[model samples]
Target chain A: MSADADTKSVTEVRPGATPAGPPVGARQDSFAARLRRDWPLLVMAMPMLVLVTAFWWVPALGNVIAFQDYNPFSGGILGSPIIGFTNFAQLFGDPQFIRAVVNTLGITAFQLVFYFPVPIALALLLNSVVSGRLRAFIQGVVYLPYFFSWVLVVAIFQQMFGGAGLIAQILRDHGHSGIDWMTNSDTFILLVTAETVWKDAGWGAIVFLAALSTIDQNLYEAAAVDGARRWRRMWHITLPGLRPVIVLLLILRLGDALNVGFEQFMLQRGAVGSKVSEVFDTFVYWSGLRTGDFGYGAAAGLFKGLVGLALILVANRVAHALGERGVYSRS
Target chain B: MSTTKVSGLAPWEEPGSLAGRIGKGGVLALIVLAVLLPLYTIVLTSLSSAGTVNRVGGLVLVPDGITFDAYRQIFSDSVVSRAVLVSTGVTVVGTAVSLGVSVLGAYALSRPGTLFHRPILFCVLLMFVFFPGLIPTYLMVASLGLKDTYWSLILPSAVSAFNVVVLRAFFMNIPRELLDSARIDGAGEFRILWRIVLPLSKAVTAVIGLLYAVGYWNAWFNAMLYIDDTRMWPLALVLRSYVVDSNPLPTATVGVNGFGHVAPPTLAIKMAIVAIAVLPALVIYPFVQRHFTKGVIIGAIKG
Candidate 1:
């Protein structure tokens, strides 16, 4: 399908300039001629290119500071002494950085294990609803929180669960003391995970719901006619139909496992204490901006970026081997 | 795939046993309650009088009495009112600029194998793999002297590579015949884009525009990083400071001798700010929600 589309687009472009004439040699058009013909298009593309170069490409080049003793006051990135692997070595040796790595992995694992299934489950439940209007309303309501900022989500959670919040007031009315849910370090992971589930589970279900809509209804009818119960039909027909999408999403999730989230953790870090709340992104922010250890922070961030890149490449390769269209196709 | 238009319901599908219906209904009810109850409380608390809020300690759950005092107080405060204006200006200007850039670039890139197209497309795709990390982006913004400026929020995120790719895919899907016929009629590329392409692409454009607007409105991290002046903070940043950080509302003044003390409880003020921050999104959400599924599916297929 994609190959056919690509060729069609190519043909479409070809007809724009040389439609009524015999085929000119592919190389016959001079660069200046092509430039004159397509200059308007180039002009349209220029601002985006400039912005991309300035914001993306230039900062990308700034990754070299990971290798330097990058003191901002000491002549910026250029005049900083280039130390080979010294910052990375220090990063690996730092206990705080190690803690951040461990915490990031721990959060990723919890999300994968606990939070990942909520969307699929919600999608399945919604899929069973015979009333489309009701399902749409529920979906809309649930998706609302996904649009809220992390700060707002945290504030809402605090208002509902904090020591002096609604739940606390209710508890006090029952002659019990309020629970310190928001600031409790021991339950930090659970709290954050719950917050994530509340904010994202409905929105995340969208892709799965789309996937479900594509399932052939005939299969379900056939299963039911074969004396299959509803649960049996769901287990056999529904789950199997969803397998490819589930696998695709799972692989993508694994590729993104390192990014447990930055803003969510950042908002709650002060309340929960950094010992429990620190993740890789916050670690970079604190070290780079707050403490002015640019080289070490840059090294840590570079390490993370490389790992993320490597994981995505490996995941895409695995998806190809399994005959799935991963994030991008080779063509 | 089934060629038949299965009527979203199967022939053998039963309404389910009584217990099953009850179970599903219960679960749906619980999910609905979970979402609505919190928002409901926040709005109610924001609208409650200070006496009721103080009586409840935090988050008024029941309506004993209603007042717009909290909203009035927040809107009157220079700090919060200015932040609201800043957020509004940023969201409007930022969305316009981003949509303009994205639409123009997507048009240019939609025709495959144009001059510099391959290299430009490669650069955009490269962004998906490697991040420049926090420090480098910060340094770049700082070096550009955009620090403490609204441009810092808008420019760094002006053209989302993902949005461009989605839009380019959509543009490519436009029947090539239409563009070609327009071209044959003496329409230039820009003219074709403006008259033919854009008019045909309203749904996706609206979707992308809303996406950018929501992003700008919800964005506080950029403001936190770039804008050091409290006076320049956007509504989201102000909401964070007064609500999440537990800072006392600067506008909540207790008059001497309690003669003119009109400030609502700090909790009420905070909830009012939250309500204000979320109000725009809530207002626009229903109009755009239907487009989300279509937009996402298109992007997912191309991506």
Candidate 2:
């Protein structure tokens, strides 16, 4: 479908713009001619290109400061003294930084196990609801939190599960000592995963639901006619049909492995303590921006970006190796 | 998939055993309640009067009485009211700027064979893989002297690559004949877009606009990093400080002794703040929800 979208009808505009030629040859129009013809289009595209370059590309290039003993107020990014591999060496040696990495990976892994299947289950559950009105109402209720900011989400959690929250208040009423479920450092991973599930599971199910709708219902009919039971039909037809989408989303998730999200961790850092709540992002925020250690922080940030890029590439490659269309196909 | 059953169950689908049906209904009820109950507490507690709040000693699980006093106090407070204005202003202006830039860019990219189209689109797609670093993004915004400015909240994060991609996809689906036929009528690309494309694409456009608006409304991290001045803060940042930080909101603390009026309890005041933060999403969701699901499906569109 998108392939059709990218085909150029503009080449058909110019009398000499040979539609018969290869796409490469057809666009061999002189720069000045092309400029005169396409300046409006370029003008339209300019703002986006300029802003993205300024905001995204420039800062990305500026990660070179990761290698420097950079002081922004003094030398700026340019004049900073170039130090070789020192920041990275220090980053590796820092126990806190190591912990942040481990914590980030741990959260990602835990969520993949415990939090990932929730949306799929939600989609199946919602799918089985006999009434469309009931299904839509439930979907409307559940997807509400996806729009909430992490602060709002954390606030809700605090009001529900914090030291003086509903859960604790009820526990106290039941003659049990109050439990501050939100601040339990021992199960920080589980706490985060639960919050993630609450915030995202319903919204995530939308994609699975979409996939389910697109599945051939006739397959189910055939399976039923062939004497496949409900569970057997679902296992054979429903899951297999959802497989491509499931794989694509899984690959995308792997690409985002390093990000356990920033704001959720940052907000909770003080409450849970840095030992438990600090992830790569909070580490950068505190060590780099907050403390003015730009070079050291830049190093951590660079490490994360590079590793994330590597992970996505590797994950995409693995997906391609499997017989699936993953995020982008080899073709 | 069949809808032939009297109970809305499909013919091929099993109704399940009695216990199974009960279990499913109960689970669905719990899931629905999990969302509704917390929301109910926050909203109800916000409405609970000072006397009711004091008696509950917590979130008023059930409202003894309803009052707008908490909201009245919140709006009366300079800090929160100004922050509300800031958040609204930012959401409006930021969503506009983002929509304008993204729509224009996506239109440009939608048509193939534009000069540098491939390169520009590649740059955008590259953003999905490589993000700007935290410190560097901060430094860039700071060095640009946007620190403490409202544009700091809007510009650095204005144009979403995903939105652009979605818009471009939707634009491409407008049958080529329509745009070409318009071209034959001497319509410029912008005119064609303004007249033909946008008119045909309202649902997706609104959906994208909604995404951008919600993003602007929910964003606090940028305000946190850039607008160090507390007075310039948006509602989301104010929410983080007053609600999440659990710092006593000025209104509840300042009470009759200072402001010469009874204030609702802090817990009620806090829930009111949360209610303020959340109300927009709740109000806006139902209106656009029909489009929202379609938008999500579109977002999952692959090249």
Candidate 3:
């Protein structure tokens, strides 16, 4: 939302923006001279560039393995036979892959409906509290779980809802049968959404809370002066003030729709079975690691990455069309 | 907080009705209790004695007999103890390296019009959207001969583009006059970043460092992927086996179980493992809690 945050798109390199430095194309602005002046800065940036290359860029290029009949042991990436669209052809034909895509998209839509409003509600509720001490205490308690790993979050849910968990124990004590919600595939989508809410609702609210704080209180007062009711003030002033943050996050979430997370589903895949638990990431993981169909898995993953890229660009365009600054501002 | 002097209301705002007050207070308290109750139960179960655990049948709620037997048992076990050490070392070293590299990168890219900064920043942003395919990354890691090594856990995940950008935002927010003042005094970018920028960025830096440390501590998948050797597993992976999978520790010191024997209950030990895994995050949270409003939100939300 600031001029500093948006580097003009990659096509444009405006050297005129440099501060207190010699203008580009100047006699002293040659590469060697700039390197002499900024060698330390380049040195500082070297480690990151190297790590990003080795980890990010190289492997991104390696996504080409998706196009090959990749066998890690015999052929490796280089020796693999090229098999254009065959893996993807196989991917689209497979019922299991179809199920995974459906499940992933289903979970994304489900969380958007059930889980997305939680942090907004939490921020509004927290903002209403008169006591800062109490609000901080709630934030500290709630955000604690966000730092916990998926293994730990799932374990906590298990302790609360597993067959021998506290709720089950309580039910058994009351002469009812104990049910293992952890293994209940029928409600797996809801279960994961609940888990997501429990872990992230507070952390997500931090963004909204920031937006809320930035809201002009005078608007509320003026609305009140005009005989606007509390709900009216909230609707007219508060929600609109938080609109940009909400839209930005919504776009980001839309871009991330295909990725419902790996470890969460992978951990539960045993209890819930792949039929219920399979998402895009776990599909790639299982088809790659478990079955060693590296090319097949790579194809599925490549499909996901490309779609995600498309989704983000499209979402950004949509946001621009809606007159909001999306992830990055365009004009 | 800005309107605190006006009795929790902006001067022009109306006071709440009794019903409204009751409703808000009730809902807020419920949210607080929902979060705390499970945590309380886990901690209580971790401390419960064998008799106490059986009395509750699972996840001891009412505290009857208090003993450190479960904690003592897990700590005494070589597997859990060594895993704890591994976790601590990885968290420390990984967090330091990540924070160092990220801060250095952020500073280098912090200056807006530096040489090739735009192209480099664009590269970072490009990676921010599209991660490398997982299978490809795994193959790369395996090909690099980093399998089963701690470096596999650290290197692949060290430089998060998100964190770097957030930190860079905070750095960029610093008044340019401050940096220009040092530049006018003939101080280099390194000297200026160290003396002027870093000193002013302690809170954001601390929050970022804690985020990395917590990430490193809580990470298990990397270890699960790369370090198949249970002997080299971190505490989180161990926690998964014992707590999530309900698998017994191979080196469990108190494997024998009876109703009221001296050994802690199996449930208590499992819960104890959960508690141990959660403790570092719990301990480190409050220190960073102070920075959430000031540092994290501004770096993240405003950016």
Candidate 4:
């Protein structure tokens, strides 16, 4: 069914094969006739156009706020004072902004290095479970946390690790003083990374599990028949089969590397202090909303967006060079 | 494909050495413990009496006494009850609107030779790379007078590009001949979509709807950004402020009518809030877990 659909769609794109082109008047008439025939499809697409225009394109155009003073009460976008490059200059000079960038990079680096392999490891562990029911139960348990809000995750972590938390209480019961794991600035990054893994590692493993299932079972049987041990078969067949997906996910992760998450940091920022917890997103929120520095905050946000765009483009290019399908293909 | 399905082990596939089995069991046990232990503590603590919670000085490992007082207090409080209603309303309305917009768009775009197909798809795909940035989006919402309104929560995120693309891929996978035969029978696009495409694509549609519903339910950041009125806050936002931010629950304002003036134990209250927030997802997740792998794999392959 899918193959037939693919071929039909492919044929729909074939260029006109006639010896002579239709006359200009005929072409115009045909365009109108085609529109008439496909008006329902156009109507179906209209809501999307309206929505994308109002929400996406309009807000995207509001990126111009990065270049303006942007007082909400001072008229609007048009009435806002134009200040070319001033916000950018201020953003670069601000030490807090610099700290946010440094923290974002630092946290993203930690996630890329330490957090990336966790799901693969998890998927492999689950795949080795011969009992299907046990595997399914484990997968369900692990994936449950992914649906939890950061607010709830943070609350759970705090209840476990806060100064007056379960762990602290346990320690104090043993005649030792309580430890302030949640509010300690030095370990904030580690804490957030642990929370992320706890929340998402299992969910992330679903894709890897899917990839693992697609590996030919015959390959494993053949390897076993030829005196290959279980571990050896996994090393030869499983890892190689998962390589493309790993690389694809890695490239996609790089594109989002700068966004090290907003809500998690925002929720926890007060407990850990801004010096250690200020990521790019929280920086924008604090500056724009709390301090009322909309222009500088917008400039910082715009900078992050542009960097993200460039990183995705570069990643896609590199993926194409490696002969792998990236996030999108160039038709 | 069925060759590997023998009930007993194949000749080449012996159960591993005893130590290997033990090691695997230990690791799996540890993983399961890591997930369940925290949850167990939270529930036990929530059920523990206020005296036990206070005496323990934190989360209760063992329930000294079981009581529904904490849950009772939370549901009785107008603030928490109102927040729950707000969250439910937002999730229902938002999911319906999002699915409506996404289904129409996906069906239209799934037709290969549809007018402006390439450009529309390109526009939607562009959303993956270029975010409009926080300050600008806030400015847009505020300027458009959606601030402090539920529309602010529902409109800006009405159509997810990822959902649209995933649904379109699923739609395109339906047999071309089925659609063609329907067309030959003089079925209009709306009729064919309603009578055929939608019915055939229930699994993906349900998966997408669940995703959107979960997203809407769990969403609090948008509320924090756009909502200035405390009365309009969702449960997640209320959870954040009351529990994570360590703010005292508004017991004084909740009035002293039903029970005594004494407030519930803060720890029990906090855990109960977490429980309230997570209960819905836990209820619905098992039914949807099987579909996630299939839906995600489809989206990944199409992408």
Candidate 5:
């Protein structure tokens, strides 16, 4: 489908040029010849390149500040003294840093167990439904929440589950003591996981649906001819068909385990007091930014980066062994 | 190999299987309900007036009355209106700037064997894997003297590694044959990219552009971290304070009051502010969502 689009674009734009070669000798003058021939294209692309490089690349170099003492007023990264392991040392010593690591790992584990299989299960359920219109409507409803910002999701949950929230009001009306679902430390893991599943499950289902479409319809007919049971067919056919895709997505998820949503944790940290809600990103923000400890934050950031990189490498290898199309390498 | 199992099945054979059908139906219904109930409450609460909301102690299954007053306050309120404008300006302009840069860089990177291509590409990949800490980023933005400037919000996030990768993939999919054909016709690389590449890549470009726009629109962390001037504040930050933080009213902390202390938050106005903050993405998503699921430009070409 996309190949056709690329072909069409090629045909439309570069007309009237050397349908055989750039008039030859255009090789030496390839730079100028190319520019003149493709001025319109160059014109379209130049500004965007310059802008991106200046803004993103220039500031990206700032990552170097992570290694420096980083006094903003005195000078920039080059001028600041490099502090080496001191930042890393301080970070390891901080109890909050340790807690953040535990919390991050804990959340990743919980999500792996509880939220990972949700979209797969939901996709199967959706695919099994007989009504097309109902399927589309449900898909639409489920996908809407994915577009909402973490802020809005947090607000919605608070409005519904907080002290003065809808659920509490209902419990009060029924003359039953309302549960403090929002503020309770024990409920944090469940609450966070539920929110993630609610927002992403449907969106995540799209990949599964794509994979499902490749299933052969004739296989179903053949099974039916043999009078195979529905449950048996599902277990044998549907589950096996989705195995490659499921493995691929699982690998990707594992690669991202070290990095959860930073905004989500930051938004709720004040309420939960960071004791339970603190994650690696938020800890970096608080200790590094708020407290002006540049080295510590960078060290923490480096730790996450290393872990994430290792996971991606291992996950990709696993996927390759399973004969799946992992993230980067196709073969 | 001799004990292989059959994997096909027909629905009618199980038509009378009550347990199978009922279990499937029950699971479907439960999922549908679980997803829809919270959304229903938000829509209902947003529509209901404060009086209706308080009277019910929260949203009812069915709203008694609908009001655009929340939306009205969002547009009419001074604080909200300014924030909304800032967000709009940033998203529109920022997306354009980002798309412009990303497309060019991606095109350059997509041309394999170019000078320094591998190193540059590796650098971009490294960017995705690891990031320098926030403090360093903050100091960079601060030392660069971008503090409190609107540019602070737009520039730091301007070059997204993900978008570049997607665009690069998209460009790579353009058959070498086509570029060769263009070169044979005496067209330059830039010409081929603009005339041939840009138009055909619309869907991916649209998706990437929208992704950039939405990211910029919903972004608050950048503004929170670098932008200190309230005049430069975007709507996401305002939404964070008003809607997410639950201030009784939409308030600006910039430009001190007579007492020179922080202002009190108003709840009713806060709800309206939330509505306004989300309005742009809501208005724009339906228009571009079709392009969004195009797989981040990862896949083999059909040719």
Candidate 6:
């Protein structure tokens, strides 16, 4: 109740709290008292702060290598020559790099069109099911695959559909020609989308289900009383109630469009070959480690980061324009 | 004393007809089956005899000869054994350390109007949006003289911005009056955090801990990037080599069995490795599943 009261009192408290800021000169004296009072928390917090600085912060500084020609054997980052825009120029000019950009964008586009609405659809259908026990059981089973590592997912797929896999054996048994969905370039995007859906569709449906719970029961009663059919009520009430959440998720997904997991692409790369699987992350992997072009790799990585940053900014701005809460800006 | 809300007592509406209910149930049943059948096949293949598997062409779904030979192969005095140990150690140590740090940072950042809080929060957001490049990250690790070390795996990933954000949200939800009362009692921040906040935050902590453990256990990319010594390989990396990189034969540098009757570590073995890689998370997941879902959006939507 106090928490609720505090939240409600925000408007009244703001101006008071702001002006109190100046007269709180003893705040300086109290700072030490405050710190002393908070010492236990400070102590509890020390390990995390130190570890983050030592590991995350220190390694994060290495992003500067994108400006330099980093050769690991040549005294590491310090000794690497600062080649500056040369790396970027080379990256921009390279056909493979361009192809990777195109490929990543294309994959994101496909996922946006197909994989985006799957969870919503699944959630709507599942919510309509009458059996509570059955619903929970199905939900549990559906979410299980999400916990499987990419390696396991790939292996499962391989066992089911690889050259010597289950479908092939089934075809062999039935005297039918097997479809080679695995190594085929034409269906690469579709395969990736299928994998995404199989792994995440059920798990991702969770938010929608949570949203569905927030809908008032009286609306449904009203619809029933007004002689609305189940389908009509669902279309009028359920879908509209879910729209805000869908828009929120769409913006978030758009922000992360570039990051189709590297492990999934890497696992299937050999089968499909780089011609199809050479997305940005894999391009960085190949160029940096396998090909030993650290500068170019750094440049490619920088490009990806910048584009991702730009996309998030654009997406958030668009969300704000549409009168929805974007990632950063609330309402 | 007053009685409050009651739930699940209302008579729920039965759907239109038995046929319709069956149709809905059938559709749901099919979806559940489609999701679980692959997992069933994998488990079956992992437990079957190699000959039976080979005869069946891929996965001998109906177990002709149910044997734990594949599991035996993975558990044998081979590279996998050491790899599993290393993976376990990394996961255990990494999760503990990651949770310790995340909780502290989250607590600090959760307090509104703290000095330096906003900047720290901004930095975390920046990290989430724009990552440092791989080469630079590799060079930084290598330059720090951490290559081939276990610390290379643990340290680089210790500061998860996502975890910090989640924990912070959980901490923020704690009653301010309770904290103020503790403060009035002259308890320090650390004392209050350790004594009060953490006790109340077991759910979020457990979920974050599980996530960190899984991330560490399933980490191969870091090892591949930083570690040159196959002797120091984690289970995930070794499993990747078996399943993806096509090296079923455990390398000479890796400890192998004497008779080499390991049967080229069959697809079943690959599944077994998958099982092994996933086993710890699977074990702990049921206990933490409820909290884990709540934790995702706390950080995700905030971002």
* Highest TM-score against the true fold, candidate: 3
Cα error of candidate 6 at position B175, Å: 0.9
Q: Write the per-residue lDDT of candidate 6 for residues B228-272, one digit (tens) a residue.
A: 888789988888877765575556544356533344556777777
Window of ten residues with lowest summed lDDT in model 4 chain B: B1-10
Each prediction's number of clashing residue pairs: 0, 0, 0, 0, 22, 8
lDDT of 2 at A45: 88
After TM-score superposition, what is the CA distance of residue B17 in candidate 6 from its true location, in Å? 5.6
Residue-wise lDDT of candidate 1 within B1-303, one digit each (tens)?
Answer: 122322455566666889988999999999989888989999999999988988887788889888999888777667788899999999999999999999999998887646666566667767777788899999999999999999999999898987888888888888877977887798998999999999988878888998899999999999999998877889999888788987654333522233113433387788888999989989999998888877766666554
Clashing pairs in 6: A37-B188, A37-B189, A38-B189, A40-B190, A40-B191, A41-B189, A41-B190, A48-B101
Per-residue CA lDDT of model 3 for B1-303, tens digit only, reads 234422556667778899999999898888778788988999999998878888778887777878999888777667778899999999999999999999999988876556777767877777757868888999999999999999998999999888898889888778888877788899987898899999999999998998899889989888888997777999999888777877666444444332223332388888888888889988888888888778888887656
For residues B1-303, write the lDDT of model 5, one tens digit per residue.
000112222344445378877987787778778766765666666667878867776655676888876666556556667777898899889998888878887887665433334445555555654555566567667867888888888887888877877787887777778877887898776777799989879988887887788788888899888876665678878777766666533343443233212444333444455555556666876766656445331322111
Give the better candidate number (2 or 5) by DockQ. Answer: 2
Q: Is candidate 4 or candidate 5 better by lDDT?
A: 4
Residue-by-residue lDDT tens digits, candidate 5, A1-331: 0122223333432323334322223333445565554445445445644554455455455566656776755665668889877777777888999999899999999999999999988877777665565666666666667777788778777767887677888899999987655677788989888889977888788777656656876676688778776777787788898898788778878888877789988888877678999998998888877877676676777677667777777777677677765455410
Q: In terms of docking quality, how is candidate 1 classified?
A: medium
Off by over 4 Å in 4: A1-29, B1-10, B250-265
Worst 10 residues of 1 chain A by lDDT: A1-10
In candidate 2, residue A319 scores what lDDT? 73
In terms of DockQ, the best-performing candidate is: 3
- TM-score result, candidate 6: 0.90
Model 2 accuracy (lDDT, Cα): 0.82
Which runs of model 1 end up more than 4 angstroms from their true locations?
A: A1-29, B1-9, B249-265
lDDT of 4 by residue, A70-108 (tens): 887785678999999999999889999999999999999
Looking at model 6 chain A, report the run of 10 residues with the lowest lDDT sum. Answer: A1-10
Superposed on the true interface residues, model 3 gives a C-alpha RMSD in angstroms of: 3.1
lDDT by residue for model 4 over B43-94, one digit each (tens)?
Answer: 8888878899888877877768799888898788677888999999999999
